[model samples]
Target chain A: MSTTNNHEPILSFKDVTFAYEPHVPATLKDVSFELPKDSFTVIVGPSGSGKSTILRLVTGLDKAQKGSVQNTARTRMIFQGGALLPWETTLNNVKVGFTGRKMSEAQKTHDAMAALTELGIDTLGDSYPRHLSGGQRQRVGIARALVSSPELLLLDEPFSALDIETSKRLSDEVLRIHSEQHITMLMVSHSVEDAVMLADRILVFKDGHIAEEIPVSLPRPRTITDPEVQAIIKHVQGTIPSSG
Target chain B: MKVTHTELQAKPRMTTHYWSHRGRRAHRTNLLHRIGSGLVLPIALVLVTGFLATGVALVPSRISAEAGTLLAALGASFLRLFIAYVFSLVIGVALGLLAERGRRLESALLPIFDVLESMPVLAFFPVVIILFLKANLLEGAAVFIIFFSMVWNIAFSVVGGVRQTPEDVKAVGVVFGMTWKERLFKILLPSVFPAILTGSILAVADGWNIVIVAEALRAYAPQSDKAHDLFGIGSILVHASSTGDSTTLLAAMGILVVAIALVNIALWQPLLAYAERFKFE
Candidate 1:
């Protein structure tokens, strides 16, 4: 809805397929997508439906054996569990992605603090990961990913473990980050409301293939009550089974 | 009467705080109770042992039989062990990191450590002597034996610690952009602190057992024709077996047990306490 000029794809996954084990048939098969620049895309699917596989392949965490993926090399992933290193303070954890790199310690600390401060967690710089609340930890997760100034940010159900309110708050934070940083975001979220509220496009995966790509033409700072967003949500709900 | 949404949320939040406070209080009480209970056992032992030693002749028969000499031997052995422990810890940590990072190398080298652990230290006494003789590393020979006895446990424990690292934690490291060294130092080492301490405690025990044998075995001087008497539990056992000294042998056995107990309390207990401060999340 933003622009019909779809000539350039920031990331292209051409017929990618992957499996967890050799004996098993592919968890994802012939999955293909072209993500445009600075787009907030959400992939929703049932469990074992290759939503995570897509994220992993895009982030280069796991390679696809069957097909090729072309994307920016500097892709940072935010794991579902907010896997902040337990030993690190919030700032140090953010800086861990830059340790021993060309950046000076002072610069690393400053950059890490800037990221945390942007997420409204600057006071938690010295606090260890164990000390933070669930929402706080997710904020740290976002900070860690953003601190690297990555070209592409991959989010793997980063709010699934949180309460509904916390999840919404985190989603708002993520939206703020996307708008501010302008990083291409590909998130895997199961919540229909989450997909509605944040994503520019919602991708529905079924049986290892992207079954549907629904575009939201809703206005910025989108809320759940927007009629267009609700209709799209209803459409996505109808397309996917209720159990998912 | 409808409760506000904030009021509804406040109830669970307040309850959580209340429960966590209660849990903290219970934990503190439990710790105090355990400490109190542990003191009783040590006090009762002191009473019983004092009663047993009453009116027994405290004459110094051999150097080890004398309390002063036994104390000195314990101190020297402890010093040797401390040196060995420091070296093993450094080497084990380095090797463990390498082994964890290098899977192929780990598979190759880990079996050798397993075999070394399986081989009893006593079985290698002759080998240690022969090797020390050929190498001519005089001052550090006893320490070498101590180090050898302790190294494998630390290495294996560290290896296990690395392997047992939760996938969630590793993912966190990757997401955060931790370098190999930062991951090893901050993520890996702190995560494995308990295992390292557990292995260290076992290693200290093993090294203590081997020290007496090492000193006694090395006390033999062939050319001088007068063996410098090695004074330890092993020496006591040797003398008792040779001359049919039952009471003294029992006394020596008691001494060895006490020595082991003291070392466990003084050395390993503190380390264990320190390690336990950092619980697994």
Candidate 2:
């Protein structure tokens, strides 16, 4: 695995509290965490446990009602739904990621193809979103996010929308990306198996707060069948509070 | 020995996966060719419109005096519709943006727009004429009426577009760090486009239907016939009907039908097809 060995914090949420409105109950309360550069962190919890909300906060789509959210790294998100612009071809949709950049149109197209090539999806460039399968669309979403060469990547339930086989395949590819590029990732997911497979750190959330923050130091190429991987998964599951 | 994440990355991105997506796009392109005989409609439209534009240029010089009068009336009516549609588009986009500014404003404005829009084309005309004639604005009476006909639906469509914008698309704007200007132009406007297209198509159809009644403003202000100068398809048809001039009436009817057809085929249909890309399927 490529090692950056940079221990600087890229993102921090300090005593942050968030709510959709005054009447609505808080989605998060007194949440605090730090994401160091070049690590893969996964937030895992139940449906309303504020996992996805944390990702949104990182992306600045929702401001914390109290405290502060500070980040030094440029970030991009791979949304749960892919969020591919329906009007554009896969290549064109990926190109929008470079909207503010000074790249020429030809360069945008070239870089977009290169990103797709990295995701193993260059052949799907000319196709529109409607023409693509769920797996293909998610790969396109990843390509769009990676094209910016962002220091941070946010993924909100990236595999919740995919099937079993596709999810496993995508999860492995994401693991490869982390091992190869060392881009800091903050992902929210429902899959404990995915957390064990990919994350360098696993954060268990309950009632809008972090219940446990566990560092994962398993060797590269860890599998669920491995005892250490299963032990981490079991530990994370137990750390999560009951749904009631 | 289990294949791990690193080994998986070495797996070839299978060619079979490309067949459905890449293949489908190629199939659709081929299908478009098959349906329209190699996409000749555009080439044909350019050739036809070019020839007509040239013929139109030589109207007074080459055409008969009677035909020229018909063409002139057609041009006048078409010009009014064009101007009115332009006004409608500007007002529609402006009002749409305004309506989205707040929930209270939308709640206040939407019902008012609905009530006015649902009223018949004639309901607003008499009031508008009274005001225009009182202000000595008889020349603009028809154009104003057409604007009213076209603006409401387009405005509502804009409102709907903003309200129904997908959450993920909004997140896209936030994540990409798009500025307010970029978000409005690139993301927000494009998200609202299919609705705008739908509204505009209906509004133009409504505009054409009402232009006839609108141009009969001369009936209300007979004393100002020379001042009003309401020369158009509506006026010609009105005159031909009252005089029982069968030949002129048939010619006017024929040209009106042809004009609406050409516009639908050339402009709206192509745009509607292009809008399929924004479906978010």
Candidate 3:
């Protein structure tokens, strides 16, 4: 969430293209972008516009078949689904995201707890993800991504499954965490309002290309109703099709 | 007025009664309930057929008491088998992980495991007897038989489990910078719990049958003894058949059947349930 000019770019995708099958066209077509270090960038697009694919590429889930993707910072991805190991508790799910770190068990648990605490669901640590509400599950996903102290966090529609009220609350919580942790975040979202509210720069992906990059330049502690956010929302709405 | 109040109470009570009866109907019609109920007819038929063919009336004497004894025997064997099973699991899972993680190594080694699995373990009797004789190792034959029954399943299951791990989950592990050891214990093992348990249970069941051959035949038993010295259920059945002691034969067979059934019910089912609980949708 740091939008200041002093930091370097933490990640870059230069003309990267990828496809599941060689015969099919690339899902992402020569897409390029830079994530300014410690800043929040949201990639908004119609469904199947390759926003999720970009996040996947950055996180190394799918390798870029063409062009290059360079990540200067250590990257961890929060899948759109919580992806909690079915057998583990919420705390353990968060802990899974930090496996093999040289930190002591105590430190790992402590860090996981702190992340959960930041999201205001510390008491639910012992509860399994199966028992949690959708919003709570997403919180576990976020805690998991952050617990690793990742330098770059990729969120693939992490809040899309929740109710609007819960999504807004979680968004605010995520923004607070971003400000506190100073982690660079690249989130894939469908909501223009979400992109405008949370991003330092909103990159609209269309037909696998970044059709627009609308810099919010809005003040910190902004809301959906902010004039600058509404203007960016309008601009993104204009550039991208209403239906995917 | 008092009578009217009593009638009102009785009306509510009758409605409660009606709902309770309706609840039973609902439960009985449920899919799980139907499956549970359907199990009764087939099992009863099998039991009746098996019992009638044995020609031994279900007597309250030793015949009934032997069921308890058979249960105890099964319990003891289960403990021993469990120990072997655990050892097999560790070794199998380790090798499985190796095979999965190292494709080239797996290709080189897998054919051997395949050969081992396909080779009828019964064929190894003479070789085991000869080896035990040469090595002056008592019980070596039994150990060989048990090991033969166990190793392949463990290895196969472990490999399957490791191979079946979802790509997304593995990617998560890599992103977290998990060491090889961490990946094996934390990610691979839990992910393959169902497969491992399934394989191990099958191996254990297979071991029971093989143990009968190893114990009853006693390839090196004295020629004059006529196999009567053997203490296993198979030996008992063999003796009973030759002597026309049909009741004893059926009793022994009953014990074996019961042992196998108890294992499937008490042990394998629970293991399967536990493993399944870990399985991701």
Q: Rate residue B165 of model 1 by lDDT.
A: 74
Best by lDDT: 2
Q: Which stretches of candidate 1 lie over 4 Å from their true place?
A: A1-8, A20-24, A100-107, A225-227, A238-244, B1-68, B94-116, B136-145, B175-178, B218-279
Tell me candidate 3's interface RMSD: 16.1
Q: Quote model 3's TM-score.
A: 0.70
Alpha-carbon lDDT, every model: 0.70, 0.78, 0.70
For residue B245, what is the lDDT in candidate 2? 61
The per-prediction i-RMS, to one decimal, reads 8.4, 7.5, 16.1
True contacts kept of each: 0.27, 0.52, 0.37
DockQ for the candidate 3 complex? 0.29
Q: Write candidate 3's Cα lDDT for B153-235 as tens digits.
A: 87898787777766666666666777777766777788888777767766876777766555555444334254323345555
Pairs with steric clashes in candidate 2 = none
lDDT of 3 by residue, A1-244 (tens): 2323436678888888888767987788888888887789998888878888886777676799889998767778776667677678888889887765668889888989888887777877887555677887888888888876778888878888889988888888878878987888889898888888888898988878888888888877787776767777888899997662
True-vs-predicted CA distance for residue A223, candidate 1, Å: 3.1
lDDT of 1: 0.70
- TM-scores for chain B, listed for all candidates: 0.68, 0.72, 0.72
lDDT (Cα, tens digit) per residue for candidate 1, span B73-192:
556666778899999898887777677776578888888777877887766666666676667653366777788898887888888777777766765555455666766667778888
